[model samples]
Structures are given as C-alpha cells and as structure tokens.
Target: MTVADTPQAAAFRRQVLIPLKLRLFLMQKLPMAWLAGLRLRQLTPEQAVVTIRFKFLTQNPFRSIYFACLAMAAEFASGIQAMMHVQAGGPVSMLVVKLEGDFTKKAVGLIAFTCPDGPLIAQAVAESCATGEGRTVVCTSTGVDEAGDVVAIFRLTWSFRAKC
Candidate 1:
C-alpha cells in the first residue's frame, strides 16, 4: 500500500489534518472576531471552562501567566455563564460595575473556571426582569493551574437589566 493510500494515513489526514487546517484558518486568517479562536467547548449555562495555552506574548517574565490573561479568563467564564442564563429571553447586557482579583500563584499552564447553576444568577436575572430595572450580582471565579492549584480568585459585580 502506498503512503497516500494507507488507511492509517487517511485516518490521520481526516482527524489531524482537517482540524489543524481549520484552526490555522480561523485563528490566523480571520479579521472579524470576538473570541480570538478561543474554544468555548465544555461549557454550559451553569458552567464555563476556558482553555488558554500559555503563549509568550501573553505571559509574564519567568514564563509565568499574565495577570491580565487571568482577569480575561475570569470575565469570560462569569460573563458567559451569566449571559447564557438570559438566553431564555430576559436581559440586555451585564455591566460589570465592580470586580476584584486576588492572585495566589503563578499560572504556567491551561486554566479552568467553573461556576455552576444556582440562586445567584437566577436572582440577578429575575430581579432585573421583574422590575425592568437593574440589579447587582456578584459572581466569583477561581482559576486553577495545570497542577490543579488555585492561581487566582476573581469577584465581579454586574448591573443587569432586561432588554425586553
């Protein structure tokens, strides 16, 4: 069997080649973007997990993760989770009025922030929708490094209002 015609080669071509090609296209070749090719997979209304590969440009000296990147990840996780709760026809936008962060350790690998479903988001959305006014919700997110160590903790308070 020739290399091009081998079954294993064909499988690799399908699985590895196509995804890599798509990644390069979307990540490098695109101009109009919001996500910057960040994957939102393993996410849901109750939870948000972001995977960021440590890149030099986005990292601090000593190969440590950047604080700004940690902040971004926190916002992404909390905001997306909150937004998804409003997908059932309830809100305009979440205005982050106040937020605080506590950096505990140096992050050197991918991090995940998870906030599950509960009264907090519901209360915030409900209050905003009920009055057609705004309410505040404080959401906390913790980022863990590759070793499952707490790298950072963030708290965001948002003023929410219904678009309807």
Candidate 2:
C-alpha cells in the first residue's frame, strides 16, 4: 500500500517539498521541455497550481510556445500532484500509460495549469492504499497563458505502484 492518500501521508509529502534550492536546481537541470521558471502554488488538499513563463530564449524562434513543451508542463504538473497524493511514507514509481491534449490556443504569456479535477487522483490514491492494489488516476490539465487566455486542455492518465 501507499502512504500518500492518508492525512499522515499528505503531511509527510509536504515535508519533502521544502528544499527551494534543490527544487530550483533540479528545475534548471531538467530537459528543455520544462520552463526553468516553473512555479508551484498550493491551492487545496486535492488541488495544485503550476505556473511557467514562456521564454523566447529557451524556445523555438517561431515566436510561439512549442506544443511538446506545453505537453511536458501538463504532464509534470499531473505527475507531481499524483505523487503528492500518495507515498508519503516513501517514494513510489509512477508511469503515464495514456495522455491526450487539446490545444485550445497558443500559450501567449506566463501559463498556469490547475489541477481542478483532483478528486479522481485523491480517490484512486486512497483506494490504492486501502487495497494495496495498483490503479490509474485521471486528472485534467488546463493551461492558460499570460494574456489570461486558454492555451491548452489535456487529460492525463497515470498508473501508480509502490516503489518496493
């Protein structure tokens, strides 16, 4: 079973996200798909908000945010939110079996993806911990760019399993 679905697990997960320096360094080292300026904001028990600036220097010269980059942003936010929902006792292996995206519009400015559909994640996480059975959690990925316009909508599906 996983540890992150319970109150104890959530609290423990919060403890592990405390290293700002490490977080920043890792952000910098990650592949180009992620905007180094990615910022995470906590909204609620089952919600997570991630913000990223569209930078020309790190992007293609076409003067538009790349589709793959946007997809990565959505995927990363979803994975982290899922991880935060489980395994507070220790780390777990996560995988993305299926993912679908709808490009609503081009990301114009700093973009934010909200995990408003967190119930699916929270419920699946709780169920996994209770039964020690692995399952998939589905979450929505909504992206809005700097102009306060919708840039993309995505459906992220992830399968969680204990790292043991």
Candidate 2 has its poorest 10 consecutive residues by lDDT at 1-10
* Predicted structure with the largest lDDT when compared to the true one: 2
Candidate 2 local lDDT, 1-93, one digit each (tens): 222256764664465356574265446666443345566655345666776676764365667677777777787677666766664434456
Clashing pairs in 1: none
In model 2, how many backbone clashes occur?
Answer: 3
23: Cα error in model 2, Å: 2.5
TM-score of each: 0.72, 0.77
For model 2 the TM-score comes to 0.77
User: Which candidate comes out best when scored by TM-score?
Assistant: 2
- Residues 19-125 of candidate 1 have per-residue lDDT tens digits of 45535544664322123333443444345575555676557887876777677767767765565555544545678899899988887767776545324765677
Native-vs-model 1 lDDT? 0.63
C-alpha lDDT score of every prediction, in listed order: 0.63, 0.67
Candidate 1 C-alpha error for residue 93, in Å: 2.6
